[model samples]
Target: MDSLSQPFTFSQRAQKLTGSAIREILKVTARPEIISFAGGLPTPAGFPVEEIHRAFDKVLSEQGRVALQYATTEGYLPLRQWLADQMTAEGDVVSPDEVLLVNGSQQALDMLGKLFIDEGSKVLVESPTYLGALQAFSLYEPSYTSIPTDEQGMLPEYVSSPEAAGARMLYALPNFQNPTGLRLALERRQELVERCAAARIPIIEDDPYGELRYAGERLPSLLSLGRKAGATVVRLGTFSKVLAPGLRLGYIVAPRAIIDKLVQVKQATDLHTSTLTQMAVYEVVRTGFLDKHLPTVRDLYQKQCGYMLDAMQQHFPASAKWTHPEGGMFIWVTLPEHIDATVLLQKAIDKLVAFVPGEPFYAGADVKRNTLRLSFATVPEEKIREGIAILGKLISEA
Candidate 1:
């Protein structure tokens, strides 16, 4: 038999893996004419190009040999210390020893799955959560328990249920959640942490967009609250949103014991994230560059989000409802119950606009097909208006 045609044995996990729904849509929307709200991409205009160039220059020039050499799997120390200090400042007292840098929050998610999940392990998650996280954790073949979630976030009362009580872990994206762009209510944050802690369930708090708030006061993170109540909360942070995604830098802050095991798992995976990249990132952020740069990014996103919401209000049907987020790149639209977003997406694509249908974001059978997510992060104000108008027309027709 020809090697290409031969049937090769594959692992059960490999056999079960499916491509990311957003990434597949990105392929169709790759056409220049398509106005895509399908991806979680940050605007390229927000990246600090000159600063990144300067940081790379400084690192390579100042320590060329060391920058190129292999380093410990724990990652660059100064970067770890900086992460620890930032967490401490955020009210979660952390030590450098508790930090482990990974390729991105995506990798951290995968490593967490490897560390904690076994086949049939019950993992709890929001009804509609980050699809990337779903993709990462799904590989472990764990059975997911979809917690009841809403605009204010997951219902804490559900944590007392038998499914949640036996869950091996609970995953959340509390700040400007990807699909819904909803923040967990402040009171629910503490109660959710306390409930899960009492059950001895580890909470995986993935916070990639925590700093992108455009309105309202910033709320305390689950990590901070969990620590106060003696709960096990592991936080995942990334510079992808604030800096640049191309750098592929993210970190995990957990209990020392968890960090120690994740370090071992990562060693067997990639040995370490790129040393040169870590050093360059440290060089850029060490000077408090994000503090200055992020304000401009926020202003631009707020304007773009406004344009989208305004256009939606003018063009969408009266029955359609959508989230009004204080921050983050997405606005989740909920159409009438009879409309299937997947079917609607094909029509939107024909009109040169694209969005992610909300079904795949759910972990269980109660998937809602009337929902879709629109991202305004990379779209210009004019394009956002144009795209929302097109989507609104299609949805109204549907």
Candidate 2:
């Protein structure tokens, strides 16, 4: 018999998840000359290395062995308290007891999947949703249904429709959504809160890029709205966008009952997020550095977005339709109907430019092949212009 056919076998859940296609494609675009818009990564210049170093030194000096020791499954108290306070400022009625510190918002999705999704649970997603979340939830074998979306974001009419009656959960990124960079309108937010409340379906509001807004008035978070409507909403947030991704610190704010279940699930997953990293984040937040740092990040990304937008206007074919986001990292581009972005990837790669194809973002095989996502967050201003020009040339020739 073959070694692979031994008695021992991987869990059914592990067998279900196919690894992220974007991550695999990114591996091919790692060359120094490749101008990539395939990732949701933040610029290296925005990371607070000095502040993190200072916090690390203080954590070691003051907390010593405690910083490296095993911590509670609920996470560090001060970190939880700080997160609660931050959410409170955003108008969310969050208590420390109702918050769970996760490794990343990504891990929170996994925990939610473990806690809620059964083998055949129905989950609703925005069309062209975040691929990473799709990958995270796929392990549970949930049936995904993609709902139609517009510039104002996911429409509320679909959630309670007869077709979506069996959906256990709906996932959305209301502000500065990934791939599309579209924000949910304030009116739609209220509509969704009411509809989901009446239907008794929970909403997972993921807002990793909300704080990276560069323009327009800041809108209230879905959690804040959900609280007012008495709806069940689990809000996931992260420091990866405004702070640093390496810290791997994120949080989920939900009902105490849900938090308790998720905490148990988290305990089985990784025991807890890093105590040292959590302490560093706690210290950094306590010192009020984040308030000062956020504006700088917004300013840098705003200029980059503008550069890319200008280049797109100059280079892209007139038939190509693209979104001009007010804030956040991406621009969603739709090519002529006959084009397939995945097929075009090899040609773009040959020109040292790469973007994620939009097909994988959809929940099913019926995807718009002409669409692609461009990220302006990681590339420099000059590179954004150059890359868009190159991509435009490829589009024109195609």
Candidate 3:
């Protein structure tokens, strides 16, 4: 009965990720007065609540008992077909057989980790990439390597080098990337796909924010370019940004072989995402609500982004450098070299503002203590101005 004799010990992977600084900091940011630019959450105001209710009722009325029941691991056939058609329209040669539905793109990342990443296997990521992706892949214990990126996106020269070939896989957010909101340039996309193909490296192209473009011309997705280059690419997307996040609907487009593996992993993970939710989302897509609804969300975020950028220009110190995103929820800021964003968080929180420090985005070294991510997705235009003003004051004082 001694405490030392207790039989419970967590797995090594769980232990390795137990004290994530981001998760620990999230606890401190929950206060109501704190204007948080840390999380990549969409504003609840834009969720099409009435349409979702209608879609739910229609699905139940139309499908009866089937909507509530369990579904195949491959997902609702019509939704898969619709996604295939969308990809086709986007210039990707996709088929229904190549798609597998998941709870979210987050789950798609996890499933990809489980399917391909062995413990200690080398994986490549953008220098300041999506933190959730870092967290997901970390659970699988991959040896992560940070690839250099600029405002344009990942450096093609580095990605195509033999050093990159040593990695088991590369994860990229080609369109409106998280944290930075940087879009990968079209020429670089073509170069990356062709180079990775030549090096025989598979890419997991996570593109949840592609449809959220507010300005500028659309660039072809890495998946499309990969297809042209005859490469093996797995593309993950979500309805979260477009339709609603609560629906928890996302899908993966990959080779039929990779889809098969991911389906097996998905079956083990959550028994095929919610069939009810999938059906509801499918009905909404069928009704053409998505096509009409998404533009409104885009316009709202665009105005909000513009408001934040304007405020930053007016309020921020001359030394501060920030990315001007064409679309998406985030803006990455680089402060003076003497400033540590993590240390500044305490002061920021005391001033009722919060932002994610840039250090956690890196794989190992603390190269960017001067950096931070600001989100414009959740806050209104007025609040964005207030938040940036607060952040500016803190930075100037620091």
Candidate 4:
């Protein structure tokens, strides 16, 4: 039969998969003149190109064959040890054996889904959560229970609800959460961990933006708090935020049991992450490079966040409200209940400004269409001002 006449069947998983809303929006905003705030991309200016180049050169020069050769699925020993050390230093006692390197935290999420989720399993998440996590977990066809959230983050009291108590897992992005950019309060973190532990629900703490804090004092991670509460917290972290996303390097730290299972899943998936990239990253970060590098990143993000927030204050309608994030790349805006952000995006694009509508960030059908997300990490100060002004005018007119 001709290709056009061919009939094919697709798996239920494949059928359920939907394109990322932000990615779809990005295609329309690709024109240079469009001031796009739709992506969660880190500033290209923050990449340590020279240092990365030097590290890669050193790795090839000293360990050429080893760098190119296929390595263990568990990842390079030195990198895992380094990650374990860093986690331990951060109050979460971890061992190299408990660390599993993945292509990125995105892959970590997928593998975790494979490890834990089954068809129709219940997964608890924040009301307005990271879209990526929802996408990853949805592949396993889990029923989501979105917990009530606020400026301080997830409400611990909700975890006691019957739906939450019986969930297979609780997915959280506690430190500078994606889309919302809200950090969970310290007390809530402790209480959430304790409650989840009592309910026998594991937590997946995706902390890609933890190190990007600019204004507030650093709070203890859920992984660390989970330890005291006897919760099995699987923390996923990435070098993408601090270094370069093109490298696609991230690590997962968990109990030996979980790490062992995830390693098996990864072996079936991509075997292991690139050996050269892992070695190069280890070489670059081994000698306190991130200590110097991160401050610069934090400073840039802080300034950009300040610029966006200030622009919003000057341009936005008094009826609108938005999160003032202390750190991370995004600010969540809640427009008037009558204004749908999806419709606003099309209008904003006509004015050469674009932002992600926030409905897709939510897991349930009961999403607030008035919400949207703004990312400031890559946009210039002038563009931020210009774009927010345009968006403001559009909202006011609406």
Candidate 5:
């Protein structure tokens, strides 16, 4: 590689953009020997490989030419319709036209940033929200306002903070949010919808983990409530969590007007999501495969989570605390007030265990350095026990 002897003049945005801390760490943890809980990767055991293969074969045989043809920016008709049906079943009463398929929910987030954000625009998010979202939205350089969050999730009440008071929109994860597996209470959802509607602030509800619940009652999405409240809601949904991430399929449901604008932007972004993949995913999931497959996924994750939690209880020092997620890939672990998780990650890597420190999830310096996120979906129960035991011992010694 030729090094630039001259100073390269990168764009201001390009200059500021940095890689995800977790992704950078993944370079080292990619070693097969590492017991990593760093990435929010799904369990390989839960992938519907056989069903996907069958679906792909069928699509290639029956709809060969069309499957390979260029698709509209709005995505495949049947797939969008299926997603609408799924949302309707979940009580959103959506139209297929309102759903625009994307490469993945991550791309949808990028599209949203392009659609709604401007330089210095106020964007609100949960204090310790999904790091990917923060990294995506940062490209547009929106001024972020971190909402106060707790075990109950991001608070929906009035914001007195002068910096965050006039935020244009709130980016929330009401169902098993990443980093912190805290699901927002139904009461909080209702309050948030009503308040945001009254304030004329739109909401972007990112819900990739909505259906993977293993315990407690499944609450209505913020979009569902926002619709009933007559507020603007744009919700991103993905098959990445439930199916395979490699499929790279997801969609966004919003008002048709917003969908129209996004469609134009998307046409300029990428012509469309892979038509073949969308067709195959629809074929696999159309006749109730996820309905059957998800229960097993839920059970596996629940068992793994239980093992980690039990191990944490037995091995972690009393000063450490962790959130109990009902359903999702992560558990948020907060260590003693004095310990920083970023530093602890080095020690964990030395012990052959890895996790994502929570600091990068925050937009700015108002971060909890003592917190970290652990993933249980991919690791086996025995590995979960061993890894958490090692992490707990380290925390105890720290």
Candidate 6:
């Protein structure tokens, strides 16, 4: 009788999707007075502004109409070829046909979900995985199986066993993973690929931070290692961290057959990423500018990370623990067992300091309440020290 009062019903898939916790917190952290460590944002200082400006001008001067026109769903040909060449240089052999450019890596996660997930299908993730991955995959509503992880990343034994037999795919960020900021040790990487191969499980190797290493030896990507051993792997990469997020450009490297399917879905989604932007990006990166620019970025990030860690050591309670990341933008903090990170966040915000509570980063029931994630890359050393000081006192008082 009260149809007027009823709202439009949402699809079951849409109903399960929730907003990103970090995104929502960004609104509060936006206050200039607040010293925030909540976001995994890259240092904007590293963005080659003058170079990008020149590239855009050059693109317009050279390929104006073609750059502005609709591009192939598979992506800009030269950029795709450039990616293939770069991969080959990195020792991950692949052809340009194997790479499909997407709007960004975020879209790749959604597309992978479209390709692999079904209702009640089993999906494996690290105990604390990327919140964005959870948000993207949750729309498909898979039964999540959180694999146990250590400071070295996911444990291979649990994921390779018969108990994980029903899982459709394993999603992992083996290099400087979000939230955790921990890398999968080099020794464990090959074992993981071998085990997942034996388990007959396909892998989605999400690697947006592999190139941002500050210290330690560079490791081989799972896509390269897995392919060498004849395992199926879908690799996702993005220029957001290395280049600029505003460009919204990324690519997927997979088998030609799988890439063909993804191209169809991507066409239905956005037709293609901005043709002008793709051409402009190619102009900027074509001359190996990133190779020269990235070292400065690494040095800057290393200095900032050291500053943040030093602050944490000076101020946190004895029971509090945190990860020491060799690279990337985040540091995962674990407070005393009795301390709830969400509650701690409320107190810190009042003191004009903010951090993302780690509970939202988990997919299953055994969520950790005492943990949180901190990003040091975007914050200056002075603010990082000040913010950590305030957050430290708040936790101790609590």
TM-scores of the candidates are 0.98, 0.97, 0.96, 0.98, 0.97, 0.97
- Find the 10 residues in a row with the least total lDDT in model 5: 1-10
lDDT of 6 by residue, 1-398 (tens): 46466687767676666788999999989999999899888999989899999999999998999998997999998999999999989989999999999989999999999988998999999989999999888888899999989999999888866668878999999989998999999778898889888887889999998888999999999998999877789999998988889999999999998999999989889999899988999998899989998899889889999999999999998889999999898999988889999998988888999999999989899899999999998998899999999988898997
lDDT of 4 by residue, 61-102 (tens): 999999999999999999999998988898888999999999
Per-residue lDDT of candidate 3, residues 1-398 (tens digit): 66469698767776677565666776888877778887788878779999889989988898869988888999999999999998898789799999999989988988888988998898989888888898888898888777899989999788776656678889999888888899999889998998889877899999999988999998888888898898789999999988888788899999999998888888888778788888888888886787898899899889888998999999999999999998889899999999999899989888888888998888756368999988888887778899899999889998
**What lDDT would each prediction earn against the true structure?**
0.93, 0.91, 0.87, 0.93, 0.90, 0.91
lDDT of 1 by residue, 117-213 (tens): 9999999999999999999999998999999888898898888898776899999999999989999999999999999889989999999989999
The better candidate by TM-score, 1 or 6, is 1
Instruction: Give the candidates in order of lDDT, highest first.
Output: 4, 1, 6, 2, 5, 3
- Regions of candidate 3 where Cα sits further than 4 Å from its true position: 1-7, 19-23
Instruction: Show the lowest summed lDDT stretch of 10 residues, model 6.
Output: 1-10
CA shift at 249, candidate 1, in angstroms? 0.4
Cα-lDDT of candidate 2: 0.91
Alpha-carbon shift of residue 313 in model 5 (angstroms): 0.4
lDDT of 2 at 215: 88
Model 5 residue runs over 4 Å out of place are 1-8, 159-162
Q: Candidate 1: misplaced stretches above 4 Å?
A: 1-7
Residue 259, candidate 2: alpha-carbon lDDT:
92
Q: Tens-digit lDDT track for model 5 on 1-398?
A: 34366466678898799998988988989988899999899888989999999999999999999999997999999999999998899899999999999999999999999998999999989898899999899999999888888889988874435666677788999999998999999898998988888777889999999888999998988889999998899999999889999999989999999999999999999888899999999999899899889999999889988988898899999999899999998999888889989899999999999999989989866898999999988887888888888988889888
Q: How big is the positional error of residue 344 in model 6, measured in Å on the Cα after superposition?
A: 0.4
Tell me the lDDT of candidate 5.
0.90
Clashes per candidate, residues 3 or more apart or on different chains: 0, 0, 0, 0, 0, 0
User: Looking at model 4, which ten-residue stretch has the lowest summed lDDT?
Assistant: 1-10
